[model samples]
Target chain A: MSLITPEFGLLFWQTLIFLLLLLLLAKFAWKPILGSLKEREDSIDNALKMAQQAKEEMQNLKAGNEKLLADARKERDQMLKEGQAMAAQFVEQAKTTASAEAGRITQQAREAIQQEKNAALAEVKNTAAQLSVDIAERLLRRELADPTAQQKLVDEYLKDVKLN
Target chain B: MKRLLTLLLCLCTFVGFAAEPAESGEKGGAFNPGEIILHHVADSHEWHWFSTDNGNFVTYLPIIAYQPGKGVAAFSSEKVAEGKTYGNFKLEDEKLVAIDGSKVYDFSITKNVAALAMSSLLLVFIFSSVAKSYRSRVGQAPSGLQSLLEPFIVFIRDEVGKKSIGPKYERYMPYLLTVFFFIWFNNLLGLTPGAANLSGNIAVTMALAVVTLLITLFSANKNYWGHIFAPPGVPWPLYIIMVPVELIGVLVKPFSLMIRLFANITAGHIIILSFISLIFIFRSAATGLISVPFGLFISLLELLVSILQAYIFTLLTAMYIGGAVEEHHHEEEHGHGEDFGTAEQRAGGSNVAHLNRPDVATH
Candidate 1:
């Protein structure tokens, strides 16, 4: 190495130049650059905000869908209950009408039987009276015809009849 | 006009005092080019007496001596007198050697280095305070330091981290922020007088570059290695040729980072010093007067560059980290035939017989 080293003249000048260049950049260039960076940051914030909003909207839509589904289920259940009640009511009405019709048919059947019995009874009474009248007529006729003969026959029959 | 006249009077006095010819036998009072450069750039710790408080309490500014052989030396202007025994001062072996009877001392001061250290500490304090503010307000809008740092934080997150490193970038944010702030703070400090040449030192830049290199090497995934070695779709011969080149590329990346920072910073300093040196070189009072305006203009320009260099350095570092940590994906052809038959056939004896049979099946 040389006894007298070269002074840092070059280094000093270089450093000064670099510093001046830096100052220029700070004044003129940095504003635009930093501004761009800030813009980028703002955009990122907006994106995050948008994402949060979308998530909230999705949650709201899900809740709404669930509510709609629940309402539809409730309506279906109500319709089902009404339909069941109507069906039960129709069944009860049909049962009552069927029972009433059966009662009427049974009464009619009993009346028909009673009428037939009454008719038969009336015929039997008429027949019995007619038969008795006919027999009485024949017997009287026989007695009248035999009266002259009967006096002689009676005298003979009287001796055969006991006096008690 | 009065300020200007006073400034002119001062310049005339300084020139007259500095340019006085030496004794006939001694060399003329001419400063060497090397001495001139060192006087401007080197650190000094001595207290120069400047009158500010009407000479009640003298203000002291550091003055660096333009030692011929020695790099730079600190001498108190207050202590300097006209031929007052010149005691305890010795130039030995081209270095400023001081001998106080039996004790020897080197006239070097650590004040500039301390200033640089203190500047770094200040950066730490400011950033930490900003971070604390952010933490305290969980959901509220940012204010004060939070407002200032929030923009930078988000920019790094979205532009540097997200765009460069993609989704899995949160883990690297701390390192990026630290690097960005550290470099930026150091660069700004270097612009101040009597501060350590942190970024200008090649060793410091090398250390930073090494950190980036280590991170890149260790964090590199299998895909990165695969790309370097085999390089998808590249012919085997070409890939063999490219492997060493790609490996060398890894080393070159950090080397470039080291050089870029070191060169840029050192160049700026040299340019500024050169402009200032013009004043002494002309020796003409008129030339020196003309140079003052130009020097002021250059000083203004250097202020802007101080921030730009910092930004450029940080951006490049981010890009390098991004490249290292990025994920790569490859798509395979859908209908390619299988290289091997079914496992059973490959394992069985009948498959061995079929393997021996040639084109008889084709006929």
Candidate 2:
């Protein structure tokens, strides 16, 4: 059996065929196949990397948005506090002015009442003097009842005035 | 109905063709199992599918021989039917030797060559179709044969090429893919009834290995040869011992590549043929029960082995070339050669082994 024996004919033919097949396949089949395979693999890698980057960017954006929201909330609280303090200040100023005006008005009323009291006493004195005079005059007029008696009284009064 | 009739007719025709061979082979004699197995595995100058009672069926291939005096003696192999002579040349001891005891150079298209041709044509047709599909169906789900072959193509590239060869895998990919399909298809062809044992032939294996060796050697950078001749981290006195050792390894690598494929394919064929021969040796109808099932089991195993062998061959080729052309930076980055993964470690990885690799998985 020539089983283990390496024949020259088969060896030559096989080599020729193998080389030819390798060259032809390399040009036609493998070139395109390998090219496409590489193309697909590279694209897949790119897409994965891009997805990872996008995820990171999304996380960053979320954090930034939170920070912005915090800032806006802080500014709003500051504004509200300032607004409340201004309102309290206006209330305090209005109370002070109103108290001053009320005090001045009360004092003026007291002075007017004092002046009216003095005037009322004076009027009472005048009324009392006029009442005494009217009473004396009524009594004298009753005592001297006739006209002759009145004339003798006038002469006696003139003499008495001269002696005085 | 017409399709059905045609199918039935084809089935009948095949049965007729198949049936006649057994009857003639019986007349031919109870087959010697070992010889029969060897005959199937060897190269031949004719293509014999089967035989009939009237006459044996064979497609006589062309005989191409070159002798010193005759220059070139080319003729149809039919001239040497039953080992006849033509122009002082005859098939002597299964070789195209001159009848006058002169040396002759035979570069004939034997049965294995025919197998190679057939497989090549088939490969071209199949791959071109897949290529066209790839071109037209970019980014879409693969359908038909494209779907079937795409995963394998991707596996060879990623697992075998990218894993073992690292970044420079693309350069060697064309040759890798070519050899992968070539060996794979030929191995498959060998399994078919009436097909030549293409990958089983030692010549075919040697040719493929030679190509790998040539590619590896040619692409080898200074670092590769340097390491082989004078390895780093070894004592200076050890160069005397290590240089030859490393050199033998360089020689042995391709030798192993050749033998592994040849032995594996040849063994599978021998086993299958032996199983088939058992039925004939026993000469009992009942023997089919013992023979057919065993043969089938072995054949099915061969189906996996054939593809596996092809993958191994291509993967090793990539690793070799990867080692050769590897930039020194790669080893530095990975720490060392063996640290990346020994060839044995890579072998344990089946066709889908890339799925398990942490690096490949990340990709």
Against the true two-chain complex, what DockQ does each candidate achieve?
Answer: 0.02, 0.43
Model 1 CA deviation exceeding 4 Å by range = A1-164, B1-29, B33-35, B38-116, B239-241, B288-290, B330-363
What TM-score quantifies how close candidate 1 is to the native fold?
0.48
User: By DockQ thresholds, what CAPRI class is model 2?
Assistant: acceptable
TM-scores for the candidates: 0.48, 0.76
Which model scores highest in lDDT?
2
Which stretches of model 2 miss by more than 4 angstroms? A41-100, A114-164, B1-30, B52-54, B138-142, B329-363
Q: What fraction of the true interface contacts does model 1 reproduce? A: 0.00
lDDT, candidates in the order shown: 0.55, 0.78
lDDT of each residue in B1-363, candidate 1, tens digit only? 245336334422322112222223213566465654453344333212222322222212222344444455444333332222234554342233344433333323222333333454465557656655545654456689768776776776566665665434555555566566656677667766545555655645666677778777777788778879898888899976899999998899888877777667666666666766676677667776767787677667766766666666666766767667554532221211222223344457595646643212222
**What global local distance difference test value does model 2 have?**
0.78
